[model samples]
Target: MTTLFHNLAAWVVAWAHTPYASVALALLAFAESSFFPIPPDVLLISLALIQPRHSFAYAIVCTAFSVLGGMVGYAIGRYGGRPLLERFMSSAKIHAVESYYRRYDVWAVGLAGFTPIPYKVFTISAGTFLLDFKRFILASFVGRGGRFFLVAALFYFFGEPIADFVNKSLNMLSVAFAALLVGGFALIHRLSKRYGQGSARPHSERIREP
Candidate 1:
């Protein structure tokens, strides 16, 4: 898998200079938001690094396609994914996902869109939970757009230095970002549990002995 990824990354890097770069970026962004294991950020950053002038445009394209792909993932979950989830994912994983979604809903989707949290899981969960499409699109747009644009903006302003820093420290950054993502989801889960359950609970002053 590592070898395949390295080769694929090399291919994408080579294609960055081609006119097909934009098309490739869109496809990659789309796939990444759905079931593809690789993140589109690699292609976006490589292209931006090679052609700094068009970085923001590249970011916009990446964001748009990514959100669209997320919608597709949502549809999958909403339409015919629940049974598959039960068949494929572990009980523990399902409980974690349900708890998080039951707690956060759209905010959970947004954070997953931006962070390093295997976005495909949240995309599918959003559908299973019957979340609103409009709100899903809006949250995905904000989160994914902010993430790609932030990277593009940094490359636009800092250029090679930023690239060098990322190349050298990517593993560390990935770990840090994952930690933050998990913590954010946990907080959202807590808040959702508190409010959702509180409203559902009845006020009682009398206790009967069993």
Candidate 2:
């Protein structure tokens, strides 16, 4: 599994040298938000290193499609994920996440989107927990945009040194960031089960329980 991801990462990185890298970056951003593991940062960083002048454009493409993909992940959780989680996961535990979501919906999604905490899980779980869709989308835009554009900015100003620094330390930094949050993704392990109950409905129609 480790080797497979390494190969996949290499393959994604290779696309940066191609004329199709822009397309690959867009596709990669969209995929990573939902199903793919290796984040678009790999491609975004590589592309920026190749042509720092175009870095901002690549960031725009990355942020936009990633949010779109997050919406799809939300649907997957809303319609499918909650049912699967219920078979083995405890209601008491999932309800803990429900309460968490009810209280910190945007912060949860936003932080997940920015950090290495697997935003896909939170995106799907947001639907499973019946979080407000508009807020989810807004937070996705902010967090994903912030992450990708920060990469763009680094290369734009810092030039070559940032290329090596960001490439090597991005994961370490993300881990450090995650460490600051008490429980972080651990708090989300018990994340999704509510939609199986009375929570499944149009995102716009859903309301918090009193």
Candidate 3:
């Protein structure tokens, strides 16, 4: 699996050298947000490195398509629910996301989108939970846009050094981001337990319980 991802990343990097990289980047971004395993960052960074002047354009394409793909995930969750997600994801992963959705709602989706945490989980969970469509779109735009643009900006300004460093340390960076996600979720859960107890329970639970 590791070797396969590395090969795919290499292929994406080579593709970035071509003129069609722009379209490829958009499509990868779209797919990543919905069901693709590889994130668009691999391609986005490679393309940005090759054409620093077009870094921002690449970021824009990534952000726009990512948001669009998120909507597809959301639609699947809304209309198809767990059966659809189960086709691609494990039951445990889906359950974890459901728990998070019950606790954090929009913030969960936004943070997942912004971080290395798989944003598809939250996008689909938001739909399954019937979260407000407008709120979901807003969160997706803000989080996905910030993350992709940040990567583009770093490549634009720091150039090859950052690119080389990121390429070499990508695994370490993902681990660090994952750590942060775990910590953030722990804190959110603790705070909700302590301070949100007084609030009324979620509607679905309330209906189901009584």
List, in order, the clash count of every candidate structure: 0, 0, 0
Q: What is the lDDT of candidate 1?
A: 0.81
Which residue runs does candidate 3 get wrong by more than 4 Å?
A: 168-210
lDDT of 3 by residue, 133-197 (tens): 99999988877877777777778888877888866765465556545766977898899987777
Backbone clash pairs for candidate 1 read: none
Q: Which ten residues in a row have the lowest lDDT in candidate 2?
A: 189-198
Candidate 2 CA-lDDT value: 0.81
Task: List the global CA lDDT of all models.
Answer: 0.81, 0.81, 0.81
Quote the positional error of residue 190 for candidate 2 in Å: 29
User: On a 0 to 100 scale, what is the lDDT of residue 75 in model 1?
Assistant: 86
Model 2, residue 184: distance off in Å is 18
Which digits, one per residue and each the tens of the lDDT, describe model 2 over residues 58-121? 9999999999999988887788868754653477856855676877666678777777777776
